[model samples]
Target: MLLALDAMGGDRAPQEPCRGAVRACESLPDLEVALVGDGKRLEPLLAEVSSNVRSRLHVVHTEEYITMEDSPSVSMRRKRNSSLRLALDMVRGKEAAGCVSAGNTGAIVAGGVLVLGRIAGIDRPGLGVPILSLSRTSLLIDVGATVRCKPVNLVQFALMGSIYMRCLAGVPEPSVALLSNGEEDIKGDDVISEAREILKASSLNFVGYVEGKDVPVGKTDVVVCDGYTGNVLLKFGEGLGEGVFGLMKEEIRRSFLPKIGLAFMWPMLRQLHTRFDYEKQGGTPLLGVEGTVIKAHGRSKARAIDNALRVARQFVLQRGVETIREEVAKGGM
Candidate 1:
């Protein structure tokens, strides 16, 4: 299957994205990539890949690029030859199975809806951020995809999240939860309460309320919330994870015995740290769209971009786009 990549869209631009594309071509034999960007800059990096990989690599040149700071509409209105626009066009045209980008998250998302269009019956698409935790990796939907959402939007988010976790992450009967301030049903505002009722009555394995603290605990596979609350909770969780590790490092260095103790438990600590490293998940999948679009941070590295392509590959073979669309057609919305 063809995977379209935005080579000139990230902070590191062609180098990091091209390096990652090269990695995917070399390691994943079943996949071919279309490097959408300036061919002159990408040719050298493509040469570094093995001959077998080089054969699988394809280049689609475009003079324009969607800059990180450029408004999403600017690309839509003016930059017709932009790599980002053309890469999306390939997906809409069915020339590629899916698309992956570590650059221009907003533009990629906007282009997904505008270019490829959303799956019919879907109210709004969600940014499916896979939350890697100690016990298991769960998904947080609407994590900055839509700043505001109706109660029905949260319900669809729960449905899409559960389907993603079960199919891609290999979790069955994945527990679903409504992200809220308290475990009690009456804690949040009307939207949360309405979503709770909708989810609880549904066929999913709804496990009731999941507070912010329950996210890293890995108690549920899906946590649905409006984009605003989800973003705040996500950032807060990331800060907490960093803060805990920082405090532990300081304490470990404070005394001789502590340092020795940390050294003894270093492997375990390292494993725990790697579990929630954030980049390990690589990128967030923009779910509910007809085509797949994985959005990575603007400051992504080669390894992260590599993982993102791996994700797109999995999405294609898993037939997640078809599955989610079918599920939605069954009155999921």
Candidate 2:
């Protein structure tokens, strides 16, 4: 299984991404990596790491690196061999099954749209983030891919996200829900209202409106929204988790008894942590596309990359994208 890793696109850049790729390679004996970046600088890091991952790592040179400060659309041209662009190229050329980028979201999305292209009849594509909660796992689309979308676009997003849950996540008949301000039919804006109406006519299992609170509650398997709202909701949930965990830590540190209790509950805490670990769920798969495009978080570490690579391998092996298109055509509703 061949996967391309963008080693110079995140805040941690070469070092972090390189280490993650090495970890992934070591973890998966059959995994082959085309690590894209400056080979000269990467060699030293490889020497420092103890693993024999160097044997499986294939270096793809990209002298120019994409920084978080660089404007994605224009900065892409500044370097003929930018890491993000090269990683996309590998996927486009079928040299690798997929490319994992933790760089500028704009560059990754733009490159995916321009280089990988969209699936037939898919007007726009959204980043589908799988949400794992206590009861179930669901998918939320347009986490940050498109800033805005129309009613038709929302309908398409719902269909694609639903199909993905069925094919990839194994939700036999995933329920589709429109992200709304309220459960009432007339509660949302015209765009969302119209999307709701259109989705009601869709062949998939349309389950009416889903509010923000229902998001992590797993009432629906697919939640569709414009990127503006989707991104805010996603970040909000993440922030809440962090805040609660911080408070819990502080409380535990306040007393020796609490510290002892925490130590005893360490296993449970670890299990709880894994429940929300994005790495365990893999990178957000870019749906409504011609091929698989897994976008790892910019701060992703070793385990995340390992899981992302596995996601790529799974998509190719199962022909996931093709099944999604077929399911959409059949209107899984």
Candidate 3:
């Protein structure tokens, strides 16, 4: 399978994505990566890769790129030749099975809709991010993709999230829940209430209501909410993960015994820390789009980008796009 990559997407630019493409090619022999960026800059990095892996690398040069500061709508309108846009175009044109970008989230979402287009039954695409909970991972949909959503939109998000968890994350009979202020069905606003009723009536494994605290407790496999709430929850979870480690470090430095204790449990601590690391997941998928589009973190390193490509490849292999279309159609609006 061929996957197009925005080599100039992240903070590290061509270097990280280029290195990632090389690593992915080395690991997956059947995969080819199209690095879209300025040829002059990417050529040297491409050369650094081993000859066998380098053979799988193809450069699709683009003089322009969308910066993190660029507005999604404006960038989509003006920067037609941007590396991100070109990478997405490859997916749209069927030159590549999928695309990966660590660029501006807005631009990536905009490009997915404008370039790759949305599924026939989808209202707007939602970003599905997997959040690590105590027992298992939960799929959080609309994590900053569409901030304001209608009841029907949340219904679609739930369906997409369920499909994603089942197909990609290997969760059978994934339970879906609406994110709310309380676990009670009577506790949410009109949108959540409407969505809850719809989901309860559908064939999905609807688990009623779930609160913010329930997320990390693994109360449900899929949590459906508007992008506004989803984004806040996701960021809060990320911050909490970092803050906990920071607190541990500060406490360890405060006392000699704590430091010594940490040394004894270093391996276990490291393993726990790895679970909270966002880079390990690499990126989140823009679900409901016609093609497989992964939006990696803006500060993604080579390892993160490599994993992002792996996500795209896995999505393609599972036929995620077609599966969503079929499922969404079956569920209806």
Candidate 4:
């Protein structure tokens, strides 16, 4: 399968993304990547890769690119020839099976909606991140796609999230829950409350409200919330994980006895670290869009970019977009 990548989007653009394209093509022999960026910058990087892997890496040169600080509206209107725009264009034109970018989240969302359009019955496209919890991995939808959402939007997010977990994560019947302030049915704002009721009535395995703490403990297979809430929760969890690991490292350095203990427990510690590693998780899917769009972290490097490309490949292979369309149509949304 062929995938279009915005090589000039991330913080380590061109270099890391270029190397990542080569790595992806190396790992997935059948996969091909069209790196969209400046030919001059990317050519030198591509030249370093072995001929066998380099052959699978195609460069679609574009001098323009959307910056992290660029306004979504302005960028979409003005940067018509940008790497980000061209990458999405490739997906829209069916030149590529999917599009991957570590670019401006706002620009990706806006461009995705305008260029790819929304799937039928999907009011807004939600970004779904696969969060690893204590018991199992759960899908969090609307991590930063649509901040201000309506009741119908949250319900739609739940539907999309459930479909994602089922198709990609291999959950037969993913349990869904609303991320509310409390677990009580009466808790949450008007939007959450109304969405809860609608979800409960639907055919989905709606498990009612799940508090913020419940998310990390794997209370539900799919945690549904507005983009604002989901974004805050996701970032907080990232910071907390880093802080805890840092504390562990600091404590380990403070004592010789702990150092010896760490030697014995290094395997388990490494496993724990890998579980919370965002690099391994790669990117989150912008569900509800017409085509496959995976949003890698803006600060992504080679490893992260390679994994994100793998994710895009898996998403397309799993027929994620088509599954969501079928589910949404069945729900009569």
Residue range 1-333, candidate 2, lDDT tens digits: 888888886677788778778877777788888889998988887886555777788888768888888876777666558988888888889888888887887777777877888877788888888888767888888888888889988888888887788777788888889989999897999999998888888677999899988988888999999989988887777677678789989988786788988878989987776676543346877887776778777777766766777777787788877887777666554
Residue-wise C-alpha lDDT for candidate 1, range 1-333, written one tens digit per residue:
889998887888899998888877777888888999999999977876788888878999987888878887667657878898888889889998888887776677778888888988787889878787768888888877788888988998999998888777789889999888899877988988998898878988998998888888877888888888877777776677799999988887776787878878989988877667664447788998889888876777788888899888888788989989887778643
| Number of the candidate with higher TM-score, 2 or 4 | 4
| Candidate 4: residue pairs that collide | none
TM-score of each: 0.90, 0.94, 0.95, 0.96
The local distance difference test score of model 4 is 0.89
Candidate 4 lDDT by residue in tens digits, 1-333: 999999998899989899888889988999999999999999998777898988889999989999989999689879999999999999999999999999998999999998999999989999988878678988888888888799999999998988888877889989999998998877899988999889988888999998888887888999998888887777787787789989999999887888999899999988877787743359888999999999998878888899999999998999988988887788732
Instruction: Sort the candidates on lDDT, descending order.
Output: 4, 3, 1, 2
Q: What tens digits encode model 3's per-residue C-alpha lDDT throughout 1-333?
A: 999999999899989999888888989999999999999999988776788988889999889999989999899879999999999899999999999999988899888999988898888899988877688998888888897899999999998999888877789999999999998767999999998899888888998998888887788999999999888777776788889999989998888898888888999988877777754458788999999999898888889999999999988999989988887777633
Misplaced by over 4 Å in model 3 are none
Per-candidate alpha-carbon RMSD to the true structure: 2.4, 1.9, 1.7, 1.5
**Top TM-score hit:** 4
Candidate 2 to truth, TM: 0.94
Indicate the worst ten consecutive residues by lDDT in candidate 3: 272-281
Inter-residue clash pairs, candidate 2: 203-333, 204-332, 204-333, 205-333
TM-score of candidate 4 against the unseen true structure: 0.96
State residue 31's C-alpha deviation in candidate 1, in Å: 2.1
How does candidate 2 score on lDDT?
0.81
lDDT of 3: 0.88
Better of 1 and 2 by TM-score: 2
lDDT of 1 at 162: 85
